[model samples]
Target: MKVLMVSWEYPPVVVGGLGRHVHHLATELVEAGHEVVVLSRRPTGTDASTHPTITHISEGVLVVAVAEDPAHFVFGEDMLAWTLAMGHAMVRAGVALGKPGLGDGWQPDVVHAHDWLVAHPAIALAEYFDVPLVSTLHATEAGRHSGWISGTINRQVHSVEWWLANESDSIITCSVSMEDEVTELYGPQLPPITVIRNGIDVTTWNYRQRAPRSGPPRLLFVGRLEYEKGVQDIIAALPRIRRSHPGTTLAVAGEGTQFEWLQQEARTNRVLRSVTFLGNLDHTELLSWLHAADAIVLPSRYEPFGIIALEAAAAGTPLVTSTAGGLGEAVVDGVTGMSFLPGDVEGLTSAVREVLDDPAAAQRRAEAARERLTADFDWHRVAVDTAQVYLSAKRRVRHPLARPDIPQRPLPGR
Candidate 1:
């Protein structure tokens, strides 16, 4: 099967897990003997001299980039114009795929889009080509802000998400928890959603299991420095954790809005000197740290799926995470990893200390985590499952007017 994936974030311009998810999914699909093409916004500071650029990266995979423009953005207004402009670029790329000698027989049997950022173009292309549309909602606008739809921009985003949910033939989410959220948000008007959890390639880490060491342990946290991410909670818990294991050190990797605030909080706790802020380490650096760290922590207040937890398991590092949203579904408490209540400083401290206090038991749990990763979260298995969804969507016959829920739009050749 041939597939066209539309995403606002891709390599060299990733904002979060969505970009990595798209990259791996497309790569695995190609390995499964399918032709895949990606349409995305050009990376920041890319050469904008070219109008429409299509670059063939590898066998069975190609990427199309449209120039990015942010001059119309305001401080606090809705970004509908920028979103639509990116959507228009995707529309142009979709049109190219339908033409001969343009994208080298790149026509797609299924048009799959990730999140609401690229929904407009995904819907337009599917309608124009009369093909099946598949949408994967990585996370919703309301979910990100903890169900607060306060401003006009927030409502606009939710409205776009609703339209996309209704228009698509098939919807995919990372976990059962996310599936429920999508259903509740769309209120019984949505198509049948398939719960296809995100996956990790364990081989990429190239790590081997190691026995717990007899020294000061390192606790590692990798994520954006934001309130919802709960990085500050980790900072607050560190002092309590240190009292038990005085030599324990915390290494934080990632950059975000709350970087300075987190630093201040560390100082307030008087554990500033023990905390090391490694801002946004690259893949090699991150993996090296993962291999050395005694435990990995993810304290997200709202996580659709915890990919980092899977990575920790693959690295044979004991995991500690807050059981919030899909995270509870991802990590089995007291089985694969330890869990704590979201934003609970004491619980977070105890969870980390569990691994620190008893190294042998933590090692046993980490081994169990690796076994679970092999059984459940391999990329090959996920790719095959995703292919099934594509096939099901492709087999369905679609017509422009067949779905009256979608808003009317001009056809490609009209």
Candidate 2:
């Protein structure tokens, strides 16, 4: 199968789990004897004049990273404008790749879109090529805002998500909770939605042996420092955790808009000295911390699927996560790892205490969680399931009544 994937984030431009998800899935697809082409963007601040579009082969997959058009659009200041500009560039590259003698004359049997960020280009390219459009709605704007789309940007983003969900021939979600959320937000007339849990490369994230520690018991939190991520709740629970296990320290990894706010929260809760902000760490640094920490806590209020939980599990690190959205499924409460309700500071403290109190039990749970990876969360299985979805989408598009009629215009710069 010839698959074309459109995503705003890919390797060297990874902002979150979505990029890593795409990278692993695309590589696995290539290994499965399928031709995969990824249409992505160059990193910000990259000179477009010198490298307008970079085409390279990585792990048997062809990646075409296009440079953003020279438009005065700032992503943080105006995300919608920046996204549209990115879509324009992607469409130009896709058109060029399809033209005979101009490029490789490559055409995809299916166009897979990662999220709403690349919805416009994905839709345009799918329609332009007269192929099936498969989209994976990783998370919804309403879900992120806890069912409130108040601001203009929030509403705009929600609308775009709805449009993408409706436009797709088949939709894939990472968790059952996310599937329900997507259905509640944009349903009844939406395409077929499949729940495919996010996967990890377990071999690369092998369990690490820890040495005896002497200092404070270390607790690690690895993820975006966002309100929805519920980092504040961890800081709130720190005082209680310290009372039970004295000299317990919380190390926060990853950066976001809530950095300063979380720090202030720690100070307000009188645990400022115990909380350490380690900022963002690369994969190697992250794994080092994961292996070194006493336990990894994921206190998310709204998670599509806790990929971090899988990472921690892969590293055989004891996990104490909240049962929020897909996290409920990701971490089987008390079985795979300790879990609690979202935003429950007391519960968070209790769960952490359980891990610190019974180190042997925690290790047993971590081993069980790691064992579950091969059965449920392997990248090879994910690629196979995704390929099935693509086949289903192809069948849907081949139906005479289901065929989409999209008007095409002259290519840009023609």
Candidate 3:
């Protein structure tokens, strides 16, 4: 089988878990005797004139990274415009790939789109190739906003997601919670949605010998410092955690719009001294911290699926996470890792203290979590399940010209 994947982010341009997910899935699929081609955007600083489309083969997968169109739009300032411009560039690149003597005359049996970020080009290319369209909704805009499409941009994003869901021959969600969220938001008439959980490469993230600890018990939080990520809740619970385990320190890794806000929050709670904000660590640095930490905490209020929990597990670190969305499925409470209710500062404190107090029990849980990774969270299994979805999509029939009837509401001023 030949698969064409469209994503806004790929290796060396990773914005989040979506890039890693696509990379692993594509490589695993190639290993399984399938031809995979990924159409993605080039690194931000690369000049388009010199490198309009950079093609390379990595791990048996053909990657065509196209430079963004020369437009004066900023992603943060105007997301819709930036996305459209990106889609335009991707569409041009994809079209050129199908032409004679171009892109080695490569054509895909199925087109798989990662998210709404690449929806326009994916949809256009699938129709252009006259093949099945498969889409994976990594996260939804309405889901991020807790079901409220209040702002104009929020509604616009929601509309695009709805269109993608409806246009797809098959829809894939990383978690059961995400499947439910997509179904509810896109309505009942949408195509069949599959729950294919995200996976991790355990080999790359093995247990390492911990360096001798000296001062304080380290609690690591490795994720974006966003409001929904519940990083502030950890800062809120830090004082209480310190009361039990004196000198318990929390190290936050990753950057987001909430960085300054979270720092202010720690200061407000008077646990500023106990928290260290390590903004955006590389993969190697992340693994080092994962091995060195006493326990990894994930307190997300709206996680579609906690991929970081799997990474922590693979690193053999004890986990104290929230039962938010697919996190409940990822980390089995008492079996794999200790889990608590989302936004529960008391529960977060208790879980962390449990890991700090009884190191042996935490080690037992960490081992169990690692064992679970092979049976459930392996990348090979994910690729097999995803291929099945692609086959199902190919067998199904849908009108290419059909448009989704997404309802629109007038803006407040209008």
Candidate 4:
């Protein structure tokens, strides 16, 4: 199938799991004898493109970019507002979605939008070309904040999410938990939502598994340091964790608004020096650092299925987390790692200490994690599953408006 995939991030411009996911999905789709084209924002660490967004092939994936105007951005921000100007810019740029007006034989069979950032473009193109529109809803405000969205921004996010789901031929989410949330909040009429849990490219991530180790047993946290992420809880847990396992060090990664609060928590606990906040390390650096850790911590207060845990698993890194939302589905508890009550500091600390203090058990869990990752979470399998969802959407599109239950294939990438 000829598929046009739209996303806000690609390659070096990634803000979250979504960008990396789009890249690998596109690449593997091409590998499986499918024609895939991607439209994404310009990423950092690349030569500025002469075109609005440059087109290139990375490991067989065909990609194009359209640089949104950065001038409209707020003062002092380095990155473009992904969703703020993306919709209008994407519509204007998608004149090239299919065969240029020159009448090239190529045209897309499916219009796939990765998230809210690209939903507007997907809707516009599908409308213009009369093609199937498939949208993937990565996260919703309610799901992101444990059902605590309010005011104008909250309502806007909620409305846009509803509109995207309602308008699309079909909807895809990263987890079953999200699908339930969508249906419960938006009603069953909000298009059939299929679950395709996000996947990690295991080959790149496996570097951490095979990497050489150096120092004391370590604890790692890699993600936005924010209130929703439960970073403060992790900090509070650190005092107990250190008391039980003093030599263990914590590596906190990624950047966000709660950074100061997180730092203060670490300071108040008098473990600031032991906690290393390395804001957003690149892939190689991150993998190398992952090797240095005993287990990866994703103590998110409301994680809608974590891709970081998938990577950590692929890296043979054990996990310590709160059983918040879809995250519980990601790990098999005692098999892949251990979990605790979402907000219990003692439980969080105990879960971390379980692996760090017990070398034999942690090693057993780590090996089991790697096996689970390769078996269930491979991107190739995820791409094939996603392709099936696209085919189902295309079938629905061909029928225009059909019965809501058309025996759709199971949601992919779970």
lDDT of model number 1: 0.82
The residue-level lDDT of candidate 3 at 280 comes to 88
All models: lDDT?
A: 0.82, 0.88, 0.87, 0.75
For model 3, how does the per-residue alpha-carbon lDDT over 1-414 read when each residue is reduced to its tens digit? 989999999897898899999999999999999999999988765557865778889889889898878656778897999899889999999988888888767788999999999999999999998999999999887666555556778878888898888888899998999998888888677788899999999999978534445678999998988778889989999999888888889999999988998999999999998899998899899998999899999999889998999999999899999999989989999888899998788898888888888888888899999989998988999999999999888534655544444334433211
Best model number under lDDT: 2
Worst 10 residues of 4 by lDDT: 405-414
When 1 and 3 are scored with lDDT, the better candidate is 3
Please give the lDDT score for candidate 4. 0.75
TM-score of each: 0.90, 0.94, 0.94, 0.88
Model 3 is weakest, by summed lDDT over 10 consecutive residues, at 405-414
Candidate 3 positional error at 190, Å: 1.4
Writing each residue's lDDT as its tens digit, candidate 1 over 1-414 gives: 888899988886687778889989999999989888888877644444643355657545688877754334432243787788678867977798778897655567899989998989999998887789999998877776766666667777888898888888899999988998888887565677999989998888766676547678799999888777888888888988988988888999989888998899999999898899999887889889998899998998878897888888888888999998778987888988899998888999999999888878888888898888888888888899999999888424533332222222222211
Candidate 4, residues 238-295, lDDT tens digits: the string is 8787776766788998998888988888899888998999998987888887777878
Itemize residue pairs with steric clashes in candidate 1: none
Q: Whose TM-score is higher: candidate 3's or candidate 4's?
A: 3
